[model samples]
Target: MARWEEIENEAPEFAARVRSLFEAGTNKTIATLRKDGSPRISAIEAQFEDGEITFGMMQDSLKLRDLRRDPRLAMHCPTLEPPKENPESGPGDAKLAGLAVEVPAPPDTPHVGAGFFRVDIREVALTYVGTPADHLVIESWHTETGYRRKTRA
Candidate 1:
């Protein structure tokens, strides 16, 4: 697994696109594992800074308990429809799969006893659709393989 900064260093363009989607909005969706091993989806806000991706949880939140037990997670950027005026206006939707590691909160953090976690990326992907041709495009990056892309009609 690699940090966001390492991905940026190894694959600048791919990293930039992923960063753009994360920066385009403050809200994203995350999936985590429930106690019984089922999936749980929740809305979350993440930060990409200082070479890492981090997110916080409210004190004693169920999500925090879930993360404490199982750190595996998948995050998807907000979905955006294609622009009517220009087909190329939308970059794409981004997704990331990673493990969350609990971290110490900064002294200035407002949420007392809140859980703070950093993402250790295992895979990252961008999906592009609704273009003029209506083809589906998927670009993916992995820790070992670097980057790969595919398109389908």
Candidate 2:
């Protein structure tokens, strides 16, 4: 598991693109595990600051409960439709999978008494339509494999 800063250090350009996608909108999607081992999806707002991806949930919220029970989660950045005339011009969508490590909230924080966590990234990926828009392009980085790219027609 690695922090966001490590990815920036090792893959600067890729990290920048991923960050851009995440910052393109205020709402992101997050998937967590329910108590019964089912998947739960929630809308969340994430912050990229101090070299960490941080998020907070309302006190005793279901998502917060899910995180407390099972920290493993996947987050998807807000996405936009690719241009029909030039799909390659789109910035693409980003996703990350990781364990959420609980952290102490700072003084006078906006989310007072809420649950706070920082991601320990296991994988990060960007998916986009390649030139000609005939195939999908996936660029990914993993803790074990580092960086790789794949395409699907």
Clashes of each: 0, 0
Candidate 1 structure quality by residue, lDDT tens digits, 108-133: 99889999999999999988774565
| lDDT (Cα, 0-100) at 59 in candidate 2 | 89
The CA lDDT at 67 in model 1 is: 92
User: Which residues of candidate 2, in runs, are more than 4 Å off?
Assistant: 110-112
Show pairs that collide, candidate 2. none
Q: Distance (Å) between predicted and true CA of 136, model 1?
A: 1.6
